[model samples]
Target: MRGNIIVRIEHDCQDLPPERRSDLVTRRLRFLSDAEILDLASRRERQYPGRNLHPVSITLPADVLERLQRLQGSRWSVSALIDRILTDSGKA
Candidate 1:
């Protein structure tokens, strides 16, 4: 089976002058060819294996996130730090 192609556009043109913004709207944008799209999709599928790992999102206060990042420093990842804390507390 084949998957559908989805395109997303992200830009920071809000600060541009009205004339430039209009020009940007009328400008031609490049898109990936079908082969390129399929290749990228296949590569990403192989890059991320979705078997044992689950994804979770949590929002923390700015100060807390800053503290976490400081703790992460060079050796640990945010996930590793959180996992270690949970494991030590008998929560994980």
Candidate 2:
């Protein structure tokens, strides 16, 4: 659950005193429990489909990059599409 939700909350009230913190906060939340926590527990695999998945950097020739762009889908992410192609070709 902790890994699924990565929150980076920034606030300007840190410099202010404790009594004045709430006055400048944008909003507040109070809940007994959240349904999202339960959903996250069941959503591990869908988050990352396979093992050894990580980022890489490479320089492809302009012609090759342009050709790969044609196969990229509008909805599918560029990296995911490339990964599928590489996996199918047994290169990954």
Best by TM-score: 1
Instruction: RMSD for all candidates, in order, please.
Output: 21.0, 21.7
Instruction: Report every candidate's CA lDDT.
Output: 0.32, 0.30
- Which window of 10 residues has the lowest lDDT sum in candidate 1? 1-10
Q: Which ranges of candidate 2 are over 4 A from the true structure?
A: 1-52, 69-74
What digit string (tens of lDDT, one per residue) describes model 2 on residues 13-86?
A: 23344333221111111111223212221222345444444443333434434433443334334344333333
Give the Cα-based TM-score of candidate 2 against the true structure. 0.33
TM-scores for all candidates? 0.36, 0.33
lDDT of 1 at 80: 35
